[model samples]
Target: MKKRLITLCSTFIFCVGVQAQEFTPKQLEQVKQVRENALNSDLSWQLLESITTEVGPRLPGTENDKKAVAWAVEQFEALGFDKVWTEPATFPHWRRYHESARIITPSEQPIHLTALGNSVSTPEQGITGEVVLFETLDELIAAPQDSLKNKIAFINYRMNRHVDGNGYGPAVRARNNGAVEAAKKGAIAYMMRSVSTTEHRFAHTGGSHYQPGVNKVPATAISNPDADQLERLISSGHSVSVNINVQSEDLGEGTSYNVIGEVTGSEFPNQYVLIGGHLDSWDLGTGALDDGAGVALTMAAAKHIKAVAQPKRSIRVVLFAAEELGLWGAKAYFERHAKSLGNIVAAAESDFGAGLIYGFESNVTANALPIVRAIAKQLAPLNIEYIRANAAHGGPDLIPLRERLNAPIFALHQDGTDYFDYHHTANDTLDKVDPIKLKQNTAAYAVFAMMAANSKNKITNK
Candidate 1:
């Protein structure tokens, strides 16, 4: 009983310490200036334009990926960051050669499609088989055993668009795990509709996984219009056969790097408030919306903070690598940094598309809520609202660290209603991102990152 009482007292004292930390009037003035400068600055747009136009697509472990690494280093050095470095990352290297799909039976027609990343190629002569269609992944899994033998399975699942981008949660299962499920039912190949909200002829490509024990199969994604036509044909009582040839080669694992830059603290230099975005992208486009914007946003934000005033804790900006190929860089970073998580006051990511930041969410302890709330009040000029909930995972790349330490990660939730339309498609070019929105995102990040890094509060409850 005595021990329990002592433990509770210690917990109370710890929480009190965190709760007592707050920004002074002078610090609040500094944060406001930082936010205002970010709003007027064109740094984010300029960086994004330069990256998308100069470096192009940064496919993992490819020559383009290497160039991107060099470009990041050069940019960071030019920006006068306190320190810049790269962490090693190893991931599977896959290349796309050719991808085509055609309906050979019932009627001759072409289906626009792109090969899923790391998907196995069809035979040299290609495979001609009846196309089996499913409305959902669940339907395909419920089909009889061996029903898809020597056949191509197509899952025509529709993805709904949302402001929060929550719709991607259910619809992406078709691409993430569809191949394995189809192989379980003896499918020769698997295909699906693009996980998009817009009905464009361009097919979106993403990574798909094949279970180790399951049979290998080529997988592809067709455009929404082609999927609609195929569904209509299926409902017309006419059997359809498709000849699909998706050529992709896996050249084994290759090394990449997680590029990092920092704004060193004036006082507690060892502690951090980290911000990041993935450096790699799909091969289809310049990755402007998916992550070029993120890269530019974080970098520009840290630069703005450095221009304003030196904070108490470091603001480290990381460009995670090979995120589209299954978080190779994120996992590597966690393995190297997990033990030092206590020093991280907060972590945030800007991977979502460039859009107006509408809401703010975080995973910090209750003791830090007031500090966050105060920051949110400052963010009001940007039209950001604070969500009371503490359930935040930071970003996809931050998953390992957040789960390991149960530490704080924050999100500046964007208006992602139209984000999926160009996601992973050939249309994900520079035009997809709005310049003002990118600046707004940068502004929001700069304020929050500066405030968190300068604060005396700890992110943990006790």
Candidate 2:
């Protein structure tokens, strides 16, 4: 009983010390105001609807990509941001013209599929061959050389659903390199189950690559239901043959721009908090859930913070370019700003869909925990929990930023259980985004950015 009393007293003292080191009451009130304003406003939804509706799919280097850049600049200017600019990024440009597949032997029926990025085109007439099924990529690799001769290799791996989207990595391995492995086995084409968690018939499309020595074959993904059908037919001892037709082009190198908007600070203008999402998305979808929500909410968050309070450090929202093809924009941004990396006091990105932010986390030095905790406290009213992992990988766009230095990074984790359902598919439209959830996401970013900028002590790297 005596030991328990001592422990309770120690806990109280530590809490009091942390509270003392954190924001003042007036600052806390400002945070409350920002949160409330964000929740009450429909700015985020308006931005999301306008961008997704007006710009449509923003595949890099397309005319739509150019329009997206102009749209972002116009929006930033209209939002009264202090400064707006663009940075150039170059990437290998590829486009899909048409993709179609169907079961030819055993039964005749259409199968839904989309060509993977960087996939080579099939012959004009397409390729028809016996179907060779592999449950996993490793199984395909282990098959004897020429085992898949005159066959189309198919991998039927399914991704599991999780709130944090942990299954994406495991399932995407096949999507990324299954084609290369299949080509090595003398396959004429490669196909796999879509890396999705949906029952719908929308085929998902994403990035894939070809190796130097290996023959480049057409890579594609079929809808989940179609994959199930193929599995059933093959399991029933039927000789399944498929015809795959994909017409695509590789346009060598192309350039895109990263749109940037800044809200300057009064005190430490050079030190900044970076937050945003990739602007470029797969052409198959409108890119609403994949990144349009991220773009809109982050843009609105900075606008809200600027309206309510003049932060001590600047806030920069970067709409990355060519992210769907690769992290090209992120790489260029970090490389161009490499010398000033240490000036980035705090950074976060929202590439996940417009789900409620369920948790807040930071990857920073021990001394920065007080600021993180204070920010988490402000986020608590929005039903966001503090994840003490201290290992926050903000988003795909921040990958380059993280690789450069031990930069201060943060993540406002959204509920991604249904994000993969519409991700990279035609179903990722504006209707999938909940306005209420977007406002909550906006409020979370607003509070986090405002507090990080206005903190008494500067956030630091680990």
Candidate 3:
């Protein structure tokens, strides 16, 4: 009799737990409506095409960057957002005017290359030197002091392709600080194989920094095929000499704005869900895959949610500024709002390429798992699996937010197998994005945002 009573009690508790997370029939129907609308709508594609085409490359502090900020404000107003504004962001502005390279000895052949952001310019005639090749940055760092005097340092690290883009960090380290280290050895310039996974003859351009005491050298990236050719020439007992000319300038600190739009909530107006992507891009390409798609999809996601119903909390879409130059806008934003970070009930950013969202995960307290699981249930129909690990770092912009607070963060994992092929290169254009995949991405964000904003129980950080 006692055992039967215990079993009955356990069953009752389980039922209550299940009931605690179940959404109302009306809420479920609303979710379905939003999903269907996002899937059928071409709103995301329209926004992406408009920005990438009309605005072109939005390098930080450039004319196009100003245009992008203005464009975002105009777009927010046109979309009928409840509130729209901009926050100031200052960053060291830089520009690439021209770049050219070629092998000078053994056999003359033009090499494909581009100056890394913030790189110093070589003399008008260019800097010609014997090439000192190292397979990796560590190898270059371990070399004897002053071993590369008056030479051009080259690190040939090839990035790998992964569905999650795990190779970027390892390869990008060489791009970021390779020049500083090479300069330490008296090298006049630094070059590395592009941090890309493509065989095409296109050099990738990304942010690179110089140290205070270290001499600044001309930093650049060469196309993968060119790197391979240089490797072959060196291995065949031929001393390789090259001429590199890069014209760039670093303007003093420049100011930009982080454009933000919001949909007001019926209740809990102070609390909000943050979703957005950076508004700046590298100048080499149209910046479509790197972030234009992200900007458009997140904007459309919020609009779709507002169309269905105003959630219990607000949703804010922040188009961050100067992200490519560094996370300047995100840093300024988190610092400006440091005290009220608790208001961010949920946050996610879609900076990855417009690929199919295949998984969903969250970083929240155990008590909030019910809310997350409920959100995950709605996303399941969109083919997103619930990753119960409950540890989500979110996108790059969220790094500052994550460091500032234990705020609830989420990740809608997208398939990124081909992202690096065109990332930071001249080939990243509208044609690279598939409309079908972009639609799925839009629907996933809408479902997650709507459910997260409207859930009965508020999600809390770990």
TM-score winner = 2
> Tens-digit lDDT track for model 2 on 1-462?
655554454433224346445677788888899999999999999999998999999999999999999999999999999999999999999989999999998989999999999899999999999998999999999999999999999999999999999999989999899999999999999999999999999899999988999999999999999999999999999999999999999999999999999999889999999999999888988899979999999999999999988888999999999998989999999999999999999999999899889999999998788778778777888999999899998899999988989789999999999999999999999999999999999999999999999888999999
Better of 2 and 3 by TM-score: 2
Q: lDDT (0-100) at residue 150 of candidate 1? A: 91
lDDT pick, better of 1 and 3: 3
Off by over 4 Å in 3: 1-22
User: What is the Cα-based lDDT of residue 257 in candidate 3?
Assistant: 94
What is the Å distance of residue 99 in model 3 from its true position?
Answer: 0.4
Query: After best superposition, candidate 1 residue 425: deviation in angstroms?
Result: 0.4
Model 1, position 318: C-alpha lDDT score: 91
User: In candidate 2, which residue ranges exceed 4 Å CA deviation?
Assistant: 1-17
lDDT of 3 by residue, 147-229 (tens): 99999999999899999999999999999999999999999999999999989999999999999999999999999999999
Highest-lDDT candidate: 2
User: What is the C-alpha local distance difference test score of candidate 2?
Assistant: 0.92
**Local error of candidate 1 at residue 327 (angstroms):** 0.5
